[model samples]
Structure formats: C-alpha cells, structure tokens
Target: MPFPSRPVAKPQLRAHSKYPSIPSPSATYLVPNTSDPVGASLGGVRVVNEGLVGIGRLSGENVDKFGETQGAASGLYITDWAYASGQFSGKFNVLPDRGYGDGSSNYAARLHEVNFTFTPYYGTSVVPQTQVQATYVDSTKFTYQDGATVKFTTGLNPDTVGGVVGARTGSLFGQTVGLATAANGPDGAQESLLSFDAESVHLFPDGSGYVSDEYGTYIARFDATKKITGLTQLPGAAQPNRPANTPNFDSFTAPTTGRRNNQGLEGMSVTPDGARLFALLQSATVQDTNGGQQQTRNHARLFVYDIAGANRENPVAVGEYIVRLPQIDLNSDGSGLDGTAAQSEIIALGPDSFLMLPRDGNGLGKGTTVPILFKSVQLVDFASASNILGQFDNVGQAVSPAGVLTPGVNAAATAEVINMLQQDDLAKFGMNTTIPANSNTLNEKIEGMALVPDLSTEQPNDFFLFVANDNDFQSSDVKMLNAAGQVVSRGDGRLNAGITNDAMYYVWRLTIDAGAKFFRMDVADAP
Candidate 1:
C-alpha cells in the first residue's frame, strides 16, 4: 500500500552479455559538498553519493523453509529488515525469523519473505558489483498466548500451557542451569512458549507489520498472515524488570531496571507519513548507564509512537529522546573512550527525522582483530528534542543518571549521514575496510535500514539508502534446526573455522535537500 516509489526493478537485460553492464550516473560517484557532516550539522542535509549504488549477496549456505540455515547458523542472520515494492512480483525483503533459534530453542517468532532483484550500476567504476539480489521467499511463524505455534523454550521455563502457569518466562543467555529446556520435564511442567527476541522491523500500509523485541522489550503486531495481532508494552523504562514489575526475559539477568541485558529494542522506524513510531535503544537503559560504562553506554533511548489512529495496535507513547551514541577508540590508539558505537538500524525521515545505524564491533564476522572504528549513517533530529515522555517512563527513571544529560535534557540532534567507514568508499566496492579481515571484509553487523525513492524524474530529491548485514550466524556452511522443525545439522560447528558471512548489501545515494522538510512515501512509480 505505501512506501516504495520505484527504482528497484532493473535486472533483465540480456543480449550477448554476461551481466555486469548497467552503469551510468557516475560523476565519479559524486559526494563532495564539502563532505557533508549532515550538511554541516543539519542545515538541510545533502549526501547524494556516499553512492556505492548497490551490492547484495545472500549465500553463506542459504536454506530457509525448515531446511534451516537460511543466512547461516547461530542466531541465523539479518537481524532487522523491510522493503516491499512487490505487487505482482519482484522486489521484496523482510527477514526476522531467527530469534532465539541458533543458541537453541525458543523458536516460533518468524517473518522471512525475500525476493529482491535490483541491478543499479550507475558507475564511476566500483569493481565488485552485485546490485542487490535476494530470494528465499516465505515464512510467517509468530502466534503466542496459545493461539498455537508453541515450543518457545530457551530455559528459565514458566510457559506451561495445558498444565497451567503460562504468562511468559524464557531465557537464552541467562541460563540458570544446564537447560536445553531441561529435557522438557519439570520447571512449571513444560509445554513451553513465549520468548521472542525479534529485534526490529516496520512495514505498514495494509500488509501489517511492526516487530521489535529483544525479548519483552516487546512490540508485536503482525497480521498479513503473520499472525500475532497486537501487543505494545514498552515503557517501564523499556522493561526487563527483575522483581519489580516482574518481567525479565533474561539475557543474563542484571535487570532491576529496564533494557540493558543484551540491550533491547534494537531500532524500529515507521513515519514516511505512516504517522510516527520509532523505538531505538541498543544501548543505555538499566537506568541509563553510568557505571556499566563503555563510554557510559552513550545515552541511547529513543521511543516515540502515535501510530496515526485507528489504534494502530494501541501505540501511543508520544515522545522520549536522548540519542547520543558514538564513543569509539577501543584501543584504536589514542586509547581512552572504550566503545559504545551501539545503535543498529533505523530509517524514518520526517515526523522529526531519523536514519541512525552506528557500528563497530570489529569486522568480518567478528573473530575480531579490532580496527573498525565507527561505521556511520547518523542524522537523528527530534526537532529540538527533550520530551522524556512523562518524565522518563518509570523504573528508577534516569535519562543519563551519572554519565550526564539530564540537566534540562535536550539530547537528540546527531549528524553524520553515511560514512560507513569510507576507505575510498569501501575500496570502490570490492569492500574490505581493513583489519585482519578478508573474505571481502566489511561486516560486523551493519544491521538493516531501507529508504527507497530515486524514482528520479531528474532526481526528485534522490534517496535509496538500503544497508544491511547481521551475519552473526557466522557460517562455515550451515543447516541446523532441531527443536523439531527437523533438519538437525549439517555444518557451522568449526566455530566459524574459516569464516563465511554472506548476506550483505549496501546501496547509499541520498539527496533530500530542497530545504529539507522531507516526507515522500505514498509510493507509486513502477509501471
């Protein structure tokens, strides 16, 4: 129904050629407007060529459809994504189905869909080309509170259905014992279910979507055949609770105050006139960090919702800000600020702006040789921020307790739009940003982001973006499934013995500066 104004289709030109031809736009991939640091701190925002046009790849032993190992094994891959533009067939991308799976158990939180095709070369010569291409196509899973689709168990157990108990409770890293759901017996009597750790996603305009959860940092609302109709619950300062309001979907305990056990709600985004819905925080919470330092978790927290009426699944938490992130120098030399480049995905672009990303967790499937010093994307801007929704939605309310910011707050305004570790724009596309990393380097979770428009009737205001990657599934060729979706194992146990990370993608382009009031998203071009 909305968001996808064209420019994605391209790939079908055959005539005595073996692909790789496309090319045209290149003014040497244009990008220097004095290298916009978000147009020198938001004075209208122009990028138009961090332009690496397109590149995509999926293999790492692809598989999906219960044969398991889709983007390689171990927490599977693509931790967040969404794209659309496929009415009669051709441009897709959804990815979320792989939450508590690879670390074992707690399965059932699905969302697969992939179809992709893009092409785009607009070259000034970027050697390694792929121009986007996906294909897995179908999966839906999620249904909880006994609508069926059960199993959920990662350990702390308390889900029991036909034997009573059921409200929630399931852990993955927060082990309390040697559990593989403890052989499914005692522990409130088994049956099990409810653990979901999806991460982030947002799609709407009739196909219904919105899935954010690092386990009970919950935001569910599925439909379009993906089931789970509605649930929002975030605020209790982003819930983990411990023993206070009780939730705690343990990523290894340490809760007592919300989100920071594996930092919840990774990043979600809606607005392109879908009327707001943001939700970030892949860091800072647990009473807004200070001693849990990593540069004090760089403040984080974003949230904002008001899903444009008809009770879009009860989403109404107006605003809340605090965006700091970006701390780096984890021994990259001048040594001091030890990490917190946190933030992983987001895109919005109006209703107060968006586009986050933030990175660095070392490169190529993280067997870490360090060196990735901050990836980019940035440009937050809650129009002069400082909302703190109803004074920090509870749980020892902190907004930055000791690490600062809470003296009349303010926060938001970031800026840096796209530098994804440039390195000659990723060595003109053959990737590899350096560090001992090889297999084409560049990937230690760039998460997922989307954007679209470049329907270009002479560049209406450009746009494209895209980005992606979350290959934590570190594949060495994989297949694994067992929790009874069957296919039990085929590889991935050399402990990433020779690293494999495929599923990457990056597009970039950008423009939007006709004085920037940006909105564009009712989509309609392709015909």
Candidate 2:
C-alpha cells in the first residue's frame, strides 16, 4: 500500500461550537444524554443551516434511550470507532473494547453491533432516533503459517486469559517474533486464552472490516452479520513477539515488545474506498520505545493494511509509520509521571493523513491541585517520511525517536493540522484551576471516532466528526483492588470526583466541510 504525498494545508479552527465549555462541575456527565438535547447536542454535533445547504440539525426534540450495556459499568472502555456505518445509509457504526469475561462467566466477552439513527435538528432534542444491537459472530477460522489451523476463541479456560490464541509461523512476513512463546497474566488467570480482546474496528463499504485487538495485535475480520469471518496478525505481530504480559501488555519484556497492556489497538480507520485500513497503537509498543518511560516514548505505531473493495478479507501489509504524540504536563519530580496520554482514536482525513485523539488518563479535569486538562483530537499528514515497515516489524528491533531516523528505525513524516488543546474554554463550566463535583472533561476512554455523512447536504464532502467515550460501564463503588488489598485510584483519584457510571452518554459532533472527500492517493495500489 503506497501512500501518496499531499500538498501541505494548514488547518484553522473556527470557533468553539456553542456546546457546554465544561461538563457541569456538579452533575453526572452521562453519555448520549439520550433523553434530551440538553447534554447530547450541547456543544456537540449540531446540523446547522449552513448557507444554501441548510444541512445541520436545527432546534429539535426527540426521545430515545441513547444505548445501554449489560454489565457493571466498570469495563465499557468504548475504544471503538465512530466511522460511518457500512451497512446502511444515514447510520453510524460504533464498536467497543469489551473486556473478555472471566473464566467463570461469558457475559462480558460478547461482541455486538452498535448503530445510531441520524436526524438533523428539527425543533426538539436532536439525538439519534434509534440504537441497534446485534451479536457479533466470533471468527474461529484461521490458517497459520505451519499449515496448522487455530480456531480462535475456541472453548478454553477463562482463567487463562490473554494468550496467543493463534499466530503465524516462520513462513509469514512479520512473524519472526523475538520473544518467548508463552503468555503472562495474573497468577491464577490463564495465560492461554488466545481470544480477541477487540479494541477497535474499521469497516468497508461492503459491510466488512478489520477488528484489532490487544492480545496478539490481531487484525480480525467481521462479516456483514457482524460475525468475525477470518483473522490474521500484523506482519511481525505473532505469539513470540506479542509481549507475554497479559492485559495492556503495556509492560514489555525484550524481543516480545508490543502494544502496552490495556493500551492495545485502540484506534482504527479505513479509507473510504476501503483499499487501505489503518490501525493505531494506543501507545508506543515495546519495540517502538527507546527504553524510556511512558512520557518519553511517545511514538505511536500506525499500521496500514492494503485491501480491495469493501471486503478486506485479505489485506496485505503495505506500510507502517510512526506518529509522535504531544507530551503533557509532568509531575514535580518528572519520575512519578503525573500526566497520561494514549493515541486512542484515529480517522482518515485523506490517504497518508488522519485525525487522531491523544488524551491523558485523568477523567476530564482530575485534580483540585493541578488545573484540569482534557484530551486533544489532532490531525496528521504522513506523506514525506519513508515507510518504516520492516525495521521494527521484527522482534529484535526498537522504534526510533520521532524526529530522528536511527540506524534501524526510519521516521515517518507527520505535520499537525489542529491540536484541540488550544480550543479549551472550560473555565466557564467551573473546570479550571480548581476542580469541583461534576467538574470534568471528556470521558477517560475517549476512543471512538467516526466521519459521519451529513445527510442534510447532497454534497459528499459535507460530513461530521463524531467522537465518543467508553464509560467503562463504571459504577460509583470501588470496583478494583491492588494485590495488597488497597483500592486502585484512577486519574487524580476523583472519578469525575463524583460522576456516576449510570450517567447518560454525551455524543458530540463537529462539522467537517469536505468530510465526503475520502482521503486518497494517486499512486497505484500496494504491490
């Protein structure tokens, strides 16, 4: 997959839409705000009466329960995409990073199709009219390099989670992993469940696409029925190289470096033509880090898969590049690591260029001592740099720094289009220097992003950028604990300092003038 070069065009941010500058410092920032337009559309997506097109949501009202989850609100780390739904018109598709259920239960491990009905503003609350759900059929069909077939997600001990369920042998292009063959998880947790920890999904026109995961950096396929049809691994992402550590794999051990644990393949996008699918590593993978801590290793590994038509059943590894993430405020010592960031969501602006969201782990404005800060959605162009596909694709390699193309690592060219950080105006909402109840920013797992069509306008270029967050199906109680029996505090330890998981969903939208202008390249398809 060859990405064409593009003339540099600087992006300008008009003005912050009239949404709430900051969520109420005293209210629960629920998702979808399904009941009314107050929260859902406030400072979010509004179909405006743009010139002659008049294709934006006007004052309107509607009643629909945005969407709901099945389990404890503690795990819905919605790291899916907001990309236009490939199945139907006027619909947008969203996926979730559903954590695999424990060995004792299967409720949390299911995959479902999430879609929303788009309606322009009329007069009342303008929220999606409907929320649809369908069970995703897991794809157990896989052909490995050694001619051995691995039935992914086959019946296995739940206790043994996050293992290399299936992978390529020596014959494949990127399976020369340099790590150990086994997986590492909790003491009793099985290190053998090679199931797909589906983190992000990108769909094609024909209703087919790839679902990426954290387990083995697996790139799996889901059919129109939302069932996983077939699956494969990134060129070098196989068992041995997929750091044995379970969960985030965030902690690396040697040649087996991979996407950090918890922070797996969180963001994925497909070109409009469905020729190339791109996936972003939430953070720098073990192989990409220059032996630095979280803040130091900011290069995000972007993988490109070249496919044909809407059905990307067999995508060839065409290109891979590095996107450097902007660092956040540091702690006094700098060693304690005060800030958090991950390349959670990404959408293609055009071929070789995409919009990515990088945010800290603090749930919105997390601390009273530190000024509240939220996530930033950014657009980057990767046209000029040489492809670093082979260097770190193998196990023994390390990702070079962002600007410098070290001997083994080749740097990718990237230019920032817009940094959402500058657009902050949360002070009015009471989320500035001091934090208060309900005082927060975007949801923590701000992962899902999609370029939805502006049905209001017949113009293809008109579209909306839909960004959503994973509530983690969280509850107000202490849901997790550390080994010493202590509560594990998240983001400044304040849970929006008070926001409840049962709170409603907040769906925001931004109008992209030519969103319909599919990012493309003039060069021939990948070889």
Error of 2 at 110 (Å): 4.1
- Candidate 2 structure lDDT: 0.42
Give the 10-residue window scoring lowest on summed lDDT in candidate 2.
51-60
Query: After aligning candidate 1 to the native by TM-score, how far in Å is the CA of 302 from where it should be?
Result: 5.1
lDDT accuracy of residue 14 in candidate 1: 17
Residue lDDT tens for model 2, 394-485:
54355554323466443443323222222122222222223243423434455666555433323333444445555554433322222222
Please list the C-alpha lDDT of all candidates, in the order they appear: 0.60, 0.42
**Candidate 1 ranges beyond 4 A from true positions:** 1-49, 59-61, 64-67, 72-158, 161-213, 216-236, 240-244, 248-263, 267-279, 282-378, 381-411, 414-466, 469-485, 488-504, 509-527
Task: Give the count of colliding residue pairs in each prediction.
Answer: 0, 58
Residue range 1-527, candidate 1, lDDT tens digits: 34444454332221221211111111011111123232323424443343566677777666667555555211122322333344222344445434323335434456566766665665555666567767777765655434333333232323433343223454322321112332221133344445556767776646667777675676777766566666676777767766666665556546677787667788888776677888887878767777656677778888888987776777888888888876766656545666577887787677776778877677787766766666777777667778888787776677777667778887777766567766656666788666778778788777877766554333456556777776745566455444434445545632334767777777776666535434644344454
Which sections of candidate 2 miss by over 4 Å? 1-92, 100-193, 237-256, 309-311, 330-340, 364-371, 401-441, 458-460, 476-498, 502-527
> What TM-score, over all chains together, does every model reach?
0.33, 0.60
